[model samples]
Target: MATVLVIGASRGIGLELVRQYRAAGDRVIATARDDEGMTRLRELGAEPLRIDVAQPASVSGLAWQLDGEEIDVALYVAGVIDRGHATTPPTQSAFDHVMHTNVLGLMQVLPQVMPMVEATGGVFGALSSSMSQIGPVPGSNSWLYRVSKAALNMAVRSARFDYPKARLVVLDPGWVQTDMGGESAPVTVEDSVYGLRRVLASLGADDNGCLIHHDGRRAASW
Candidate 1:
């Protein structure tokens, strides 16, 4: 069975991924920041790790936790959103909180995990958003969130050069029904994860460093 790692799996897309991967009989090592989230992962048959990606000290211990295993799939799914638009300036604390969780956290995790992925010629997927696209500007409702995901997209693509053995790609999961997506979202969590898994499974060397949509389409532009 493939060994999968899902970071920030407390709820939403991350948690659903753990559930589906475990159901497929893959060995899953999933992370969350609290006891409650740990319990949920355990119930779903995942090897749970406590990881607060927002805190550097907490993330620093990840390498030791997964020292020798070859990971087939590693996903960086931790992120926080900011709803404030460009009409008003975000406070320093707001910017830091969003950037630290969305961009900095993944940057810290990559060094610890990419080697494990490389050992198996694995796929490393980071959850990004189509809203992050700059070519066709979307609405400015969540401008800070847009900026952070755009940065995340760049971070994964740039890091792909260093770990050539691993297929690194950013995933846009679409607007799903979750706490973050709220009640009006059209996509379901199950559908999004299913499509993401299909896309990841089909990735080849040529697809590396690309942004993939949930429906398995490679993005034409950023």
Candidate 2:
């Protein structure tokens, strides 16, 4: 069993990941901003902590709390989808909110967790999306959300250069049925998480810096 750290384990994919990891006998350290989610995590035998990814202080507190412990897997599953881009000019508040939480927030949290993963020679993964791809362009809606995810992909790439020994991956969980993916999404949380676990378990230094699909497929482009 490995020691796993899951960020944004409040609900959906994050919540399911916590459950699956615990069920597999891995030690899970989960974080969530909401009370209900934290309670659920505790019920699953995970040590849940309070964290608002948008707030740097909260993330710092978590890092300080963990201190020198080695983490086997650190998965960043926190993100937001702002449909405000569907508007004519797009709402500035909504745009800023997504960028802060999805981009800047990740930038801040990675530093605190990377060392822990490095100590254990483990993997560090970021939850990305297929929509973040530039070439095979999808619909034009949610443009801002797409941009934020694209930026996040780059951030993970940059991390690979710094943590040479650590296996770092950008995971695309497919279009799953969740609060962010919506009811129309074809994949279920169980299916996505199961595939993701397989993909993650198979990662190696050769797979570092690659964008991987939940089913273990790899992509060259971000």
Candidate 3:
């Protein structure tokens, strides 16, 4: 069975990913910030590691947690959304929280985990949003979130060069129904994670450094 590592798997897309992967009988190591989250992960048959990605000190311990295991699939799925638009300036606290969680956290995690992925010639996928697209820009509903994810896209793409053996890609999970997406979202969490797993399974050398939708459509431009 493939060994999978999911960073930030307490809820939403991340939690659902752990559930599905475990259901498929893969060995899953997932992270959560609190006791309750860890308990939930354990119940789902995942090896739970306590980690708050927004905190550098906490994230620093992840490498030791995994030790020497080679990971077949590693996903950085920790992120927070910002709803404020460009019409008003975002407060420093707001920007810091969003950027730290969405971009900086993943950046910190990569150094610790990418080597594990490389050892297995695995696929490393980060959850990004289509709203991050600059070309044919969508309306600025969550401008700060847009900026953070756009930076996330660049971070993963740039890091891909250093770990050539690992297939690194950014994935857009679509607007799935979750605490972040709300009830109005058309896509279900099950469907979104299913598609994402499919995309991860189908990664090729040429697919490296690309942004792909959950359904497998690749972005034409960054």
What lDDT is obtained when candidate 2 is compared to the true structure?
A: 0.88
lDDT of 2 by residue, 1-222 (tens): 899999999899999999999999999999999899889999999988899887877777878878877999988999998664445555778777788788887898888888899898999889989989998866778888889999999999888888876888899999999999999999999999999999988886688888999988998665
> What's the TM-score of every candidate structure?
0.98, 0.95, 0.98
Candidate 2 lands at a TM-score of 0.95
Which 10 successive residues of model 1 have the least lDDT summed?
Answer: 132-141
* Model 3 misplaced stretches (Cα beyond 4 Å): none
Tens-place lDDT per residue, model 3, 1-222, is 999999999999999999999999999999999999999999999999999988888998999999999999999999999998789899999999899999989999999999999999999999999999999686878999999999999999999999988899999999999999999999999999999999999988889999999999999987
For residues 12-86, could you state the per-residue lDDT of candidate 1 as single tens digits? 999999999999999999999999999999999999999999888899999999989899999999988989988
Error of 3 at 191 (Å): 0.2
- Model 2 clash pairs are none
